[model samples]
Target: MNPDQLIEFLGILEKLKCNTRHNWSTSGRQESVAEHSWRLAVLAMLMEEDFPELDMNKVIRMCLIHDWGEALTGDIPAFLKTEADEKTEAGAIESLLEKLPVSLASGYLAMFKELSDLTSEEAILVKALDKTETLIQHNEAGSETWLPLEYELNLTYGDEVCRHFEKTQQLRDKVREHTLKIMEEEVRGHREK
Candidate 1:
């Protein structure tokens, strides 16, 4: 909660990047670094309550700080999000946190580490929430929306994901139906004469 450290952190956070497919509100408008983090946290809260077996507070902390590294490495797109890129970002996070006070650095580093999935539970929880956000956003966006142009999944990971996570599974299926079935009607509402 140190103002000096927070200001530094926020400055770093401003440098974070996100995927190109999912734009902020307007087509040309871009989402901010803070906006990405906040939405992920919201996704965690929305989905975590259904996982009665795990610690969601941990999930919230993980999602909130997941891209603090992006403050250092910039957001890597979902398609280009490679292991080497992650390794590079990892190094950046470790170095940045080292500059902060020990107490703050310790907590920040721990949250960042959770994204690495040092353990099965932590890895699964973070992955589920991360994928869940994209899945739901995809449904909401439909074919006309921009993301479909850039991102692609093999279906294996997605099928496996929805298979294990019931809450997301419901949304995953629902998003498809809603987008496919109602998209035409929605467009018709705003169509030019």
Candidate 2:
């Protein structure tokens, strides 16, 4: 194991604790990427009870590192993502992984790739939970924190996410209901002006 290189990777990861997401907290401060990942890991552990068949280890690992690319690329909201953005993020992840010893780096890259590909069951669950957690955070962050997607939430959370991971349907439905309500309020306020 290349301890020095691994230490460098860890140092780089420390930046995530300070790298804020575009979404604001109820306190009006931007949420950090590390905060998001930590909560996602907690959710993954608790969610294991709901899916006894899948590997929780894999789920937790993916949750921890899924956004590591954002350390370099920043948290590009899914609605705003483009093929070019995706390519850039992949390149950033590839460069970061190069800092580790080959064997360990391969394992981490494989885990990250699985989430990117959304091919395995565990990867799908992590992805769904990631979205669900975002919805929950938005809900808790107050009405002022309404979703900003140009498209309807139903299109992304309902038709797309649920179609792939049916288990997330309930959460997606709830988030959709809340987001749509807030969105209407936003429109009404704008019209009154």
Candidate 3:
């Protein structure tokens, strides 16, 4: 909760990937896990006006730690999955959360639970914003590989998925446009290289 936690959180940053898939950036432009959460928490505050009914507290909390599991188990590309991988990440979150004092820990546990449970409007929007941010990143980075991006988009489904949100649905079109532009540029760069 103090400045020190922020510093310690950076150690976990090495593990989080900005894109689910590895691409052009050598370091993956991969944000450290803590930065991702911190940024998303900001996103929730600035953008929750879009979801007026959402519990802003839960949105902030969920955005803050949706990927702490990534801190322990490492991030996975959205397109690939194994039962073992999922379990390992879940266990990592459990272990990491246990390190917190009871006073500080309970709140994180509840937020993590909310993300997993996906029961609230706040959780839903936080989840949507998570995906939305990544897509925005991909477009900004102008990634070339369509398969990975396409694969990631294919992974979401039903109500729990972020793509279910209307704002993101429109944003999804933006993802496609930005991705296509990035791809075109990459192709040109590759030819010159």
Top candidate when judged by TM-score against the true structure:
2
Q: Which residue pairs in model 1 clash with each other?
A: 17-75
lDDT of 3 by residue, 1-193 (tens): 6677656655554456432333222344544555656767887788767777667877787787788787666667555768888778778888876666677778787777777777766777877777766656555545543355463462342224556678656655666666567667777999999
Candidate 3: misplaced stretches above 4 Å?
1-28, 144-160, 184-193
What TM-score against the true fold does each predicted structure earn? 0.73, 0.85, 0.71
What is each predicted model's overall lDDT from 0 to 1?
0.65, 0.80, 0.65
Name the runs in model 2 displaced over 4 angstroms: 147-151, 154-159, 180-193
Instruction: Write down the lDDT that model 2 would get.
Output: 0.80
Ranking by TM-score: 2, 1, 3
Better of 1 and 2 by lDDT: 2
How far does residue 191 in candidate 1 sit from its true spot (Å)? 15
* Tens digits of per-residue lDDT for model 1, 1-193: 6899789766766566443334343344555555666777888787766887878888788777776776766666666778899889899889888878898889777667656754646556677667666555544444445444433441333556565667767765665555555556656766954
Mind sharing the TM-score for model 3? 0.71
Indicate the worst ten consecutive residues by lDDT in candidate 2.
150-159
Report per-prediction Cα RMSD to one decimal.
Answer: 4.1, 2.8, 4.6
lDDT of 2 at 128: 86
Taking the tens digit of each residue's C-alpha lDDT, what string does model 2 give over 100-172? 8889889999888888898898998888888878766776675665454533553365346554655567667
